[model samples]
Target: MADVTHASNAPPAHLAAGTPPILELVNIAKYFPGVIANENVSLNVFPGEIHALLGENGAGKSTLMNVVTGLYQPDAGEIIIDGYGTTFPAPDAAIAAGIGMVHQHFRLVPRFTVAENLHLGWSETPRRLSGKDIEERASALSKKFGLPITPSAVVSSLSAGEQQRVEILRVLSRGARLLILDEPTAVLSPVEVGELFSALRRFRSEGGAVVIISHKLDEIMALADRVSVLRQGRLVGTHQTCDVTPDSLVTEMIGRPVTLATSYPRQSPAPAGGEAEPLSLKQVTVRDAAGVVRLDDVSLALRPGEVLGIAGVTGNGQPELAEVLTGLKAAESGTVYLNGKAANRADPAMFAHAGVGHVPEDRLKRALMPGLSVAENMALREYDRPPIGGRFSFSMAQARKFAQMLADRAGVKLPGTQVQIRGLSGGNQQRLVLEREIRIASHVLVASYPSRGLDIGAISAMRDMLARARDAGVAVVLMSEDLDEIFALSDRIAVLYAGRLMGVMDRADADRESIGALMSGRNLSEAA
Candidate 1:
C-alpha cells in the first residue's frame, strides 16, 4: 500500500526528448505455483499512443498485464509511472495511478441505462444527481471520444460494439490515463472494429495511452504504434509497428516460420445432384419465450459428403437453429427430415435415435459432465444401448475400453480412464466430445463453435476430425462466428441475419468484405 506516485531521479538514456512515459515496467517478473508466468519483461507506454502486446495463449501477456494492474505483484521489477517509482497492492491502487483495464467481457448491468451504469461507482457524484445531468455528461464524453451512444439507451439494447464503448467510457470517466483492453476485437464484426478504431484514435489524439493485448496481427499493424511480443513467459522483442511484417511477428512469437493459414485446402464440390438429402429443415419457424421470432421460416438442405457452414455474429438465431436441429427445441412450424424420413420435432430423443449428433456451443453446460470420469463422460451418448453396455445393465469395463479406443482415434491425450474430466484441459474435453459425436453420427453432424477457445494444435485436430467426417459421407453443419473457420472447412456458406437466412454462397465466392456486410445485417444479395 505504498504511495504509487513518484518522480524519477533521471530519465532513461534510451528515451528521446519527449514527455516522460505515462507507465513503464522494467524487468517485471511474476510466478505462480509451478509456473513462470512472466520473466524479465520490460514495457513502456507513452502518452498518446497505441501499444500492442502480442503473444499466443499462455505467453504471459495476461500475466504481465495483471502485474501492471496490481492484480498480481511482480517478484522482481520496477514500475514507474510518469517518472515515479510505485507499488500497487491492488487494483484500486492501479486506478489511483490513472491505469484501468477493460476485459473482454463488459461489466455493465443490462437492466441499467448507459448513464446509470457509468455513474454506478463514482464517489464524487452528488447524492441527488439527476438522470438528465448524468445523461448529458455521458453524452458529451462519448461524443468527444468519437463513440456516439445515447446515454439514456439501455445497456441490453446496445450492440456488442456499443457495449465495449460504454466500458471504455466508464474507465475514462474515472480519469484513466492509460487504457488496457484484452482481445478487444475477438467478438466484433469488421464494421464494429472500424468504429472501435475511430474511438481509439480519438482517445489517443486527446493524450491518452492504450495497451491492447490481442492475437490479431492485422489489427496490430492497423492500430498499434509499437508492438511487443512474448513467448513462453519471456520477452522476445519489441519493435515499431511499421518496421515489422506479420511473418516476422509470428516468428518472434512462436520461434519459427509460420504461414498463419486459417483454412485448409479447398475441396472439389461433390456431384450429388440426384442424391437424397441427409438432413433437411423445410420452412421451420421458431419462437423464444418472449414471443420473439428466433428463426423465421428457415429452410436448409444438407447432402451427404458435404460441409455446410453457417456464418453470423453471435445471437443471430444460430443457437435457435442448432437447438431445432438437435431436438432440444421444437420448431413451432414446418417439417424436419432426417435421412429422408420425417422426424418429430417435439421429441428430444428423436434426433439421437435417428443417428444425428450434436456438439453444442457451450461444452460445459450442454455436453460435458465435469465431475464424472473421462470414460464415463465419453459414454454419455450410448451407455444404455450400445455394445459397451446392455439394455438392463451398464458395463464400466467395456465403457473404459471403448472410451480409450475412441480417445486414441480422436487424438485426445488422457492421464487415465479413471481421471475426472474436469481436470482435463479445454482442448482435450472438446476432443472427447468430437470423438463421440462424430462416431455416433450416421447421416448428419451439427458442430457449433467447434474450435472456439481452443489452441492451435486443438484447432488443427478438430478441423481434421470434421474433414474426416465429411470424407466419410456424413453431412456436416458447422455453425461458427469465426469466419476463418467457416471459410476453411465449409463447402458452402450460409449467412444469417436477424433470424433469417440472408443467402447462401459457395465457399469460393465468399470474401471477408461481403461476409462482413452480411453479418452486419446487409442481405447477401444486396451485398453482392
Candidate 2:
C-alpha cells in the first residue's frame, strides 16, 4: 500500500512544508455485504492537532477508522504513517505502528486494576520490568495528564467517567502518536466532558494527533482544528473549524436543511379532559439493592401536551424512577395515578393494558429481546392493541401485520419480519423499540434514551415522534444524559442530582451554565 503522493482528488501542486502528517490515506474504499461503507476516502491527520471526523450514523466514519485500525481491511486504498508506507493485517499492526484506538465502549477488563490492565501486553518479567516499575510509570502518566487515576484502583469500582479517562490514559501509555476515539462523550455529563477535553489538550501539547469521531457537533467545534464530513460512503467535504457553522455541518452531512421539529400524529385524549389531572406521583421514595435511598420524598405530575425532560448524572435514581413508573421495579413507598386511575404494583402487563408505553433506558437490559425476531419484538409492545387481542386471545396474523408496519415506521432495515433483531445494528434496534412503544397511542409515555445509538436521521425521527406524542396529548417523560437532546425536545426540565430532585425549569430558563452546574454539586436554586 504505497502512499499516492500525486493524488488528483484535490490540488497536488502544494501541501505547505511541515513534518509529514502523522497519518495519511489516499482514495480508500471499503465495502460490506450490502453496503458501500467508504468510497474513495482521503484523510490526513497532522501531528499535534485534534481532527474531528464528522459524519452522521452510517456515514462511514466508524468504517474508515476500523480500516485504519485494521479491524477491517479496505478493498482499495493506501495508508501511510509517519512517511512509512505499510499495510496492516490486524489491530496489533496498527499498534506496532504507533496507532491506538479507544472505542466508544472502553475495551478493558472490568475486574482488572488500572496498572494491570494497561500492562497486559507484557509478561510479569518482560524486559526485566518489575510490577512496581510498571505501576510507577502508570501513576506518573496519570499525573502528567492531571487525570487523578490511581494505578491500584480497580476498574469495576470506578464511575463511567473515570473509566473513560482511564481508557484515554491507557492509549497514551503506549506512546502512540495518533489516537482515535469514537463518541467519547456520549456517556459523560456536561461537566465530565470539560474535564476529559482538558486532558486531551495536555496530549496535544505533547505533539500527539487525535482523530475524534463523534456526533456532538458543539464538542467538535470546541475542540477540533479542522472537520471532515462523510455522507453515504463518500467524502462530502472538509471544513475549517472556524469557517463552518452548525447549520452548514448539518447541511453537509444530511444533504439538506433540517429543523429541530418533532411531530406525532394521533388524537388521543390529553392527560386530562376539560378539568382533570392526567397522572401524578406522590411522596415517592425508592431504595436500591444495598438498602440505599435513591429517590427522596419525590412528587411530580405529568399532563397532556407536555414533554418533561429528566436530566442528571447517571445512577441518580432516574433509572429507579423509570422502572417504578413502568412497573419493571416496584417503589419502596409511593402512590402512582395513571390518568387518575389507581396504578399499583399490577405488573408491566397492567401498564400496557392501561394505555401506558415504556422504552427502558438500557435497551439490552429491559427494552429488547435480542434473540427474538424483529416481528416478535414489535408485536410484544402492542399485545393489548385490538385485532391482536382483547384481553382474551392473541391473533398471530394481526401481530405480523402490525409488526411489519411498525418496522417500516421505525426505519429498521431487516430483511423480513422473521429476521433476528440481534442482526440489526444499534441504530436499527433503537428504531424497533421506538415504533413499538409509539404506535399504541398511549396516554402516558416513558422513553429512556429513545434515540440512544441512532444516527442523525434516526434521532430526528425520534424527536419528531416524542413531539408528536406531546402534540397528541400524551404525557411524555424523556430521560437522557445528553443535555442537548433534553434542551431541544423538552418543554420543561427537571434535574436529578444524586438521590434528590433538584428543581424544575422551563426551556427558556435552562442552559449549559445552569444544567452543568446542576449535574455537578454546585449552588443552585434547586437543592439536591
> Which candidate wins on lDDT?
1
Over the stretch 156-221, how does candidate 1's per-residue lDDT look in tens digits?
888878899899888887889999998787667678899889888888888889999886677889
Query: After TM-score superposition, what is the CA distance of residue 504 in candidate 1 from its true location, in Å?
Result: 3.7
TM-score of each: 0.77, 0.81
After superposition, candidate 1 runs with Cα above 4 Å error: 1-18, 128-137, 260-278, 288-292, 312-316, 338-445, 448-462, 480-485, 505-528
Tens-digit lDDT track for model 2 on 261-285? Answer: 5333334543444544466778888
Residue pairs clashing in model 1 are 6-84, 8-83
In order, the Cα lDDT scores of the candidates are 0.81, 0.76
Q: Model 1 Cα displacement at 87 (Å)?
A: 2.4
- For all candidates, the clash counts are 2, 3
